[model samples]
Target: MKRWSRAAVVAVSAVAATALVLTGCSGSNKGAGGGSSSPANGDAASTVKQAADVMAKVTGMHVSLTVQGSVPNLAVTKLDGDVSNTPQTVATGTATLVVGKNPVDSKFVFVDGHLYSDVADPGKYADYGNGASIYDVSTLLDPNRGLAKLLSNLQNPKVVGSEQINGIPTTKISGTSSADDITTLAGARLSPKDAQNTPTTVWIASDGSYHLVKIEISPVQNGTVTMTMSDWGKQVTATKPA
Candidate 1:
């Protein structure tokens, strides 16, 4: 398999970082979800706010992502994993990466605030220290600072109507925002020029919990990145590496 560029690796590393950050100590709080097809009063902004509040209480979840044309030199076709936020955040999962024309298998684990990577070709494990970590997890799940802020700052959010995802009823919303806003939410800083415009769509569960079910980001240069989140309230735990 071909080697992945450092930048590419860091890009995907965001997955693990966010998985741990967003779930950290959130504590299991049951959501006030209803099976309604639309949000209260069918208001998009209110719906987003309500959903944000619901997701902020999630203790653990499962994430599946497909990143196509998002990063250069690395082709991350699919990634899936589980994460827990209560007490401590922990994660483990596999990713399918295509470097050049060859596909490589990569495994990742996050526990005790440390990140570990294993590549099938090398068949060895390397630890990326928490201090040197490239991705910032706290910025994603922080109710006041990260994704909540981004959603609150959404420009002209519009209701795209209701849809069903994975058999779950959801309210879809579409909007546009500066990439800088997202970078901040993800704990990344980009040069002004590099902060291209981004179009986003999000699906919030209508079951009353208003938890986020899916999100999509389309960058002018990188194509589209999609993430689907589910299994809310599931228990997840990670042990320190031996």
Candidate 2:
């Protein structure tokens, strides 16, 4: 299997998700939601407040999610599209993030709260690629993690703008990277292209739990990208291979 870089998967998901926003009735979080308040349209100041509020409720909490989203044009093809309503099941195990999508043709499971890529064994297990040490790749974009560094790909920087989602108003945020933000998001240094791969987008939510409802990423070199959260659940389990 070809290796899928974490940044490619996430940043694109960030963009493809935005398409989900377009499907709703006037971008309102009404028909489908976690019983939480509908997302709202607000400015950057309000967005940060919403993000902080929603993040406080569920951050670090393992939840079960029947997410029907897609990462189109992944690994190549510019990935300027999106997919929805697929049978994608996600289980955030108390210890790890486990995904199962028998029909979707893809599943990514994080082991014991860590994101490490193990190369296929050529008769024996060994490292691959540039041999860069892998950290908690799963937590890179998780709004709950407050580290010293943030990856250009994962950091949800200060709110930049705002837009309505699911019939609700929301705040837009730009996730830019500098020495500190990069360190806080990624725990290391990265080049500008790496930063470009990093996604910048708008966040939508009604209640405080800044549950990500919609996102759009546009990179100069790469095509457009987006991801949207269809539903949310809690205290779910993702069983992993022993």
Candidate 3:
């Protein structure tokens, strides 16, 4: 009877120890997983500033712009193309414009501060004189008045959360900016009413690169504008149309 009691006590102690070890490991894992979804470094504004600084130095990238609803002084509804800021700011892409309730698609190239598009004259490129007829893609990369400045001018930026953008992990941030800054960055115009404190959201890569992955802004009445950037540092060449 004494031997049996001693054996039972030893067995109970071993079971309790195993349970404790397992509980500890489970708690540790839970903490680690929770951290992955939290804001990095616990400073959302600083992260945005860092991302802006990084993007200001990008040489070339692929960009996509989409607009839903009407934006004042902006005619292009969609644009997709490669842009390079090295040596000069240039772009080659396709654009969709709304003309009197109809959508017109055209291939265009911006070089030497001139916009050449087949829409202006079919089979031959017509110089639009710096894209006054349509939107200018190069303005999106202007160092002082472009995306970098927009990011730097964010008001009350806060980390929304973390998510994946095209298989790349990113931290989402929300903020507001002046209509003038937003329009300058997008090369668009907004009305006085729609321009007041536009709500903006941006996604920055969380992999320590701090690259600007996406930006969305609501700067029009019942409309939204979104831009996504990818293929960073890719080579882009734009030449004048013959």
Candidate 4:
């Protein structure tokens, strides 16, 4: 039997609400476990810079995403990754938002029109009504989600700490969040939390498009969650639906 996180299940269930697109990464990519980027690539010297450069190339593109709230309170993290600026690929012109997200878990989302997940049987999630597919959410993540702007606004995130994550050495950079750190996607404005209590830390990638290899978020009042990426597949030629 497969155990899907509640948030992941909801995201999978709601994927059909957005427009869909199909694209694939060029060149050969490895599976979850094949080889890994050398530890040298994860050096603090260039981790932040590398992520910035990669995100810059993919900025301003419309990307739809199905962000599942990992926390039990799904409502809080439901809209973790909302695409407002980007036009709806499947929903025509609807903005999908979810709240109540948790940290420390994998999620289900659209990957080039394909239902994919870090978990099992992800492909079966091709249904959510309204012609929405998993890839539809992928279209919302296009750098327009304020990722690059967040990174740029960061006061030089550094590798202040490190730990072994899935056998890979993960680094942490501590800093504060800001309203400007948030990016406006499609047409909506996403403002990062400005509370001093919510100290944010961005993980450093060893190599490739260092685009936020992972992120740790803590709430002001209480609670915390983390989002980690297990794959960095090639660019999928997905576009925002008109």
Name the best candidate (by TM-score).
Answer: 3
Better of 3 and 4 by lDDT: 3
Candidates 2 and 3 compared: the better one by lDDT is 3
Q: Per-residue CA lDDT of candidate 4, range 1-242, in tens?
A: 99999999889766744323211222233443246643434455366666656665542232222233332222223223222222322112122323223222234433234433332222232233322221234333445444555555565455576655455555677765553332122122332342333456777654344545665554333445454544333333333221
RMSD of 3: 3.2
lDDT on C-alpha atoms for all candidate structures: 0.67, 0.39, 0.86, 0.42
Q: How do the predictions measure up, each by TM-score?
A: 0.71, 0.40, 0.87, 0.43
**Cα error of candidate 2 at position 49, Å:** 2.8
lDDT for 131 in candidate 4 is: 21
How should the candidates be ordered by lDDT, best one leading? 3, 1, 4, 2
Candidate 2 lDDT by residue in tens digits, 1-242: 99889999998898878777676654465555545533232345455554555543432322222212332212211111121111222222111112243231222334344322222321232322221132223432344442112211345556555576666555567664343343333333444555454555646564555665665544423434444443443333343433
lDDT of 1 by residue, 19-127 (tens): 8776753432223234433343488888888777776777778887776664432245666777775677677777776656777778767777776656434556577
lDDT of 3 by residue, 35-96 (tens): 46566545898899899899888888999999998777778899999998888878999999
Q: In model 4, how large is the Cα lDDT of residue 238?
A: 34
Superposed model 1: Cα runs more than 4 Å off = 1-41, 72-77, 98-102, 120-123, 131-140, 144-146, 184-196
Off by over 4 Å in 3: 1-26, 29-31, 34-37
Models sorted by TM-score, best on top: 3, 1, 4, 2
lDDT of 2 at 139: 36
Look at candidate 1 and tell me the lDDT of residue 221: 61
